[model samples]
Structure formats: structure tokens, C-alpha cells
Target: MECPCCSGKPYEQCCEPLLAGRAAAASPEALMRSRYTAFATSNFDYVWDTTDPKYRDEFSHAANCDWMSSSLFTGLQVLAASDNGKEGTVEFIARFRRGPNPEARHHERSRFRMRKGRWLFCEGDVISG
Candidate 1:
């Protein structure tokens, strides 16, 4: 299956390794892509696990899972990505459709941080939707 992140690679070769715990996302953009794939597949556990612990309480697993499970994720576009050794950022647009509504676009710039040698999503600023 094609990767939901639109990386043009097979799912197994792209995000599966990360989702299955066989590998860690090597960069902020990689983590961002895998998170998109997680949402696309309704793997809510992966989504929650990859979030920075400090920010986890700001979100609710049940709510996020409901949103992801209800939406049909269509595609992802990474507009920009950059990282230093300890911090990173990814600017992206994700497309999805919910219920009978028209396809919607979520544009955001996400932040990430490295902790104990693994990258984790910290937060995101929504640009538009």
C-alpha cells in the first residue's frame, strides 16, 4: 500500500517501521509523517505515545481517537521542515474529510523535541483549516 504520508514509498518501507516500534523516526519531518500515517490508520496509541509527555495532558486520547476515526485522511504535504540537534519544526498541510462535509485542509507548523535520543511531537500552531 502507498504510504498515507504521500512519500511515494510502500507503507511497510515508510511508516510501518516507526509505527510498529521497529524503528524511531529519524527526524522531525519523519515523525510528522508517521503521525499523519497513524491518524490515517486510526492507530491512536501511536499518536499518543509519540507526543511529548509534558504536553500529553493538554490533549485527550478519546477525543483525538474519535476525530481520527471519524475522518477520512486523504493526503499530506510537507511545506517545510527543519531541526537542530535537540529541537525541530515541521510545516505541513493535511487533507481529510469528515462526515458529509467537503474535504478540509489542516495547515500547521508543528514543534518537536528530542528526549533520551528519541524525537517526540511537542505542539502545533494551526495556520488555517
Candidate 2:
């Protein structure tokens, strides 16, 4: 099936490998896109694993899982991305519905860093809801 990140690629060819530990994301945008897929698929472990540990002080597997479970993701749109194979930023919109609530769009500019040869999501600035 098509990727939820709207990368114009199939899920396996796009985000699965990155989220499954089979390969590293090529850039910040790639990592961000894969993360959107992880949320769309409810791959809580992948979402938690790809997050930078420094920003995860309040993070725990159970809490992350609960957070992912609270929403049903529908789509993703990468608005912009700039990477130098080291530190970079990505702007994107993720659409989802919380429980039985109406769908909403999450817009953010996310930061990423290359650590241990892998791109990890560091943090994000929420732009809109």
C-alpha cells in the first residue's frame, strides 16, 4: 500500500525499513516522514526509538504507546526540509483524530540530528493545531 507520509512510495519501500531498524533515514525529512508513518501505523516502539533521548526525559514506552493510541493518524505532508547530513529541520503537517473527536492538523517544524550514523528526531516547534 501507499505510504501514509505521502512520499509517493509504497509503505515498505518508504518508511518501513527506517522504522523497523533495517536502515537509517537518509535525512531529517526522511526521518520525519517515517515518524509520521509510525504514528499512522501505531508503531509506538519505532516512534519512541527514533526520538532523541535527550528530549525524552518524560518519555517512557508505556506513555509513548498511550500517546500514539490516543490518536488515529490519517495523513502527512512534508512542507519543507533542510539537511546537511548532520543537523537539520523539517516542517510538516500531520492529520489525525483523537478518539472519537474531529480530525485536526498538527503543523510543526521539527529538528533532527545525526547520532551514531542515524538521524534522530530531537524536538519540534508546534505551529498549529
Candidate 3:
């Protein structure tokens, strides 16, 4: 199947390796893309697992899974991304609609940190525009 991140590649060749723990994302942008694909595919566990441990306490796995299952993801647009050694930021807009509700977009600049040679999502600052 095509990658849900809209990376113009097959899922197995794109984000599956990172999501399956077979490889690490080469850059923060890649990790962010994988995370978006995970969401689009309703793989909430990947989303939770890739998060920085410290940030995970704010969420429960079941709750995350439930929330994700409730939405119908449409697309992802990577607005910008930057890497500086151990720290990085990926700005993106993820489009989705909850049930029969109107479609909406979530714009955010998500922060990530490299830990043990793997990128982990840290936090995000929502951008409304």
C-alpha cells in the first residue's frame, strides 16, 4: 500500500522500517513523517512508542488509541523541518475529520530529540492560522 504520509513511496519501503524497529529515521523530518503515517493508519501504539518517555506521562496508551480511532485522517503537509545535531523541529499540518464532522487541520511545530541514535518526539506547539 502507499504510504499514508504521502511520501510517494510504498509503506514497507518508507516508514515501516522505523515503525517496526528495524531501522532508525535518518532525520527528524523522517521521524515526523513516520509518526504522521502511524496516525493516518490508526497505529496509535507506534505513536506512543516513538514519543520521548518524559512526554508520554501526559497520555495513556488506551486513551491515545481511542482518540486516534475516532478520527479519519486525510492528509499531511510538511510545512518545514530543521535539524541541528541532537535537536530538531518539524512543522506540519495534519488534516482529519472526526466521524461525520467537517474536516479540520492541525498545524504544529513539533520538537524532537535524538536519543541513542533514534529520534523521539518531545513535544509540540500548536499553531493556529
Top model number, lDDT = 1
lDDT of the candidates, in the order given: 0.96, 0.87, 0.90
Runs off by more than 4 Å, candidate 1: none
Badly placed stretches (over 4 Å) of model 2 are none
> Ten consecutive residues with minimal summed lDDT in candidate 1?
120-129
How far in Å is the alpha carbon of 66 misplaced in model 2? 2.0
lDDT of 1 by residue, 1-129 (tens): 899999999999999999999999999999999999999999999999999999999988889989998999998999999999899999999999999999999999999999999999999999953
lDDT of 3 by residue, 27-120 (tens): 9999999999888778888888889998999778887687688988889999899999899999999999998899999999999999988899
Question: Cα deviation in Å at residue 68, candidate 2?
Answer: 1.5
Task: Please give the lDDT score for candidate 3.
Answer: 0.90
Write down the TM-score of every candidate: 0.98, 0.91, 0.94
Rank the models by TM-score, top first: 1, 3, 2
| lDDT of prediction 1 | 0.96
Q: Which sections of candidate 3 miss by over 4 Å?
A: none
Model 1 clashes, total count: 0
